[model samples]
Target: MLFAAGCLAILLGITHSILGEVLVFKRLRENSIIPNLTGHKFNLRQIRILWVSWHLVTLFGWALGILLFLLADVNNAPATLITQLKQVIAIAMCGGATLVLLGTKAKHPGWIVLLSIAILVWFT
Candidate 1:
C-alpha cells in the first residue's frame, strides 16, 4: 500500500509540474486569460513574479510528495505515526480538491477515486 501510494505521489508530482510549469504558466504569459478573468491588467514584472511563485509552490508540493514517499518506507513506531498523519493530511487534501472541483462543476471523479483508495490504504 505504501509503495502504491508512493508511486501515485510521484506520478502526481510529475503531472502537476507539467501542468503548472509548462502548460498553465506558458498560456498565462502568452494569452489574455488573466486580464479577461480579473478585468485588470498586470505589468510584465508582476506576471513574471506570479509565474515564478506559482512554479515555486508547485515544486514545494512535489517535494512534499517525495517526502511522503520516503517517510512511508520507514519501519519504526514514530515513523508509523508520522505515516498515518501524512495519510490523514493526504485524505483531507484529496477530499478538499474533490469537493472544490465538483462544486465548480468540473470533472472530479479521479480525485474521488483517489480519496477512496487512500482511505482504504490508510486503514490497511
Candidate 2:
C-alpha cells in the first residue's frame, strides 16, 4: 500500500507539472508561469491547499524511503549504491521544495513544492 502510494505521488507531481505547464502559466512567459510578484499582493491563502497537499505527499514519501533504506539489506555493492542513490534523489527533492518555499513562484509554487516533496520522499 505504501509503495503504491509513493508511485501515485510521483505520478501526481508529473500531472501537476504538466497541468501547470499548460494551464496555469501565462502565455507570454512560454515556460514560466510566474506573474509580477514584486508589485502584486501574493495570496498565500488562496494557494494553501495545494501547498499542504504536496507537502504531505513529499514528507510521507521521504520518510518511507529513509525507513526502507535503513532497514533494507545492503550486503552487496549494488544494493548499497542503490540506497545511496535514492538518498541523493530524496535530497534533491528536498532541495526543490526549499527553492519553492523560498519564493520561487508567488502564484503556483503549489505544483513545484508538492512535486519536490513527493520526489524527495520517494527516493529518500
Candidate 3:
C-alpha cells in the first residue's frame, strides 16, 4: 500500500505538471491571463514566476514520493528516522490536500489523491 501510494504520488506529479502546463499555463499565456504582480513592465517576469511556482509543487511531491519509495524498502532503517519521515510525509500530504481543496474550492480532483496518500502514510 505504501509503495502504491508512492507510485500514485509520482504519477500525480507527472500528470499535474504536464497537464497543467498544457491545459492551464498554456491557455493562460495564450489568453493573456498574466497577473500584474509588479508594474506592467515586468509582466513576463511575473508569469515566469507563477510558472515556476506551479512546478515547484510538483517537484516537492516527487521528492516525497521518492522518500516513500525508499521507506518502503529499507527493512533495517532506523525506527526514529522512519517515524520522522512518515510524520513529515503525512503532514505534508494533508497540508497539500488542504491547500488544493481550499484554493480550488473543492473543484480540483488533486485533493482526493493527496488526501488518500496522507491517509495511507498515516496508517502504514
lDDT of 2 at 24: 42
Give the higher-lDDT candidate: 2 or 3.
Answer: 3
Pitting candidate 1 against candidate 2, the one with the higher TM-score is 1
**Clash list (residue pairs), candidate 3:** none
On TM-score, the leading prediction is 3
List lDDT for all candidates, in order: 0.53, 0.50, 0.71
Task: Residues 15-113, candidate 3: write the lDDT tens digits.
Answer: 988987787576445444332234444554555555555765886787688777767875746986677788778877887777666544465677789
lDDT of 2 by residue, 1-124 (tens): 5445555655665676556536643332323233322213335443343443444455555555544444453454777657765665566556556535543344446547656665856755
Question: How do all the candidates rank in terms of TM-score, highest first?
Answer: 3, 1, 2
**Which pairs, if any, clash in model 1?**
none
TM-score of 1: 0.42
lDDT of 1 by residue, 66-120 (tens): 5566566666478666676666566555654454344333433444555666576
Question: Taking the candidates one at a time, how many backbone clashes does each contain?
Answer: 0, 4, 0
- Best-matching candidate per lDDT: 3
Q: Poorest 10 consecutive residues of model 1 by lDDT? A: 30-39
Ranking by lDDT: 3, 1, 2
Q: With candidate 3 superimposed using the best TM-score fit, by how many Å does residue 8's alpha carbon deviate from the native?
A: 0.8
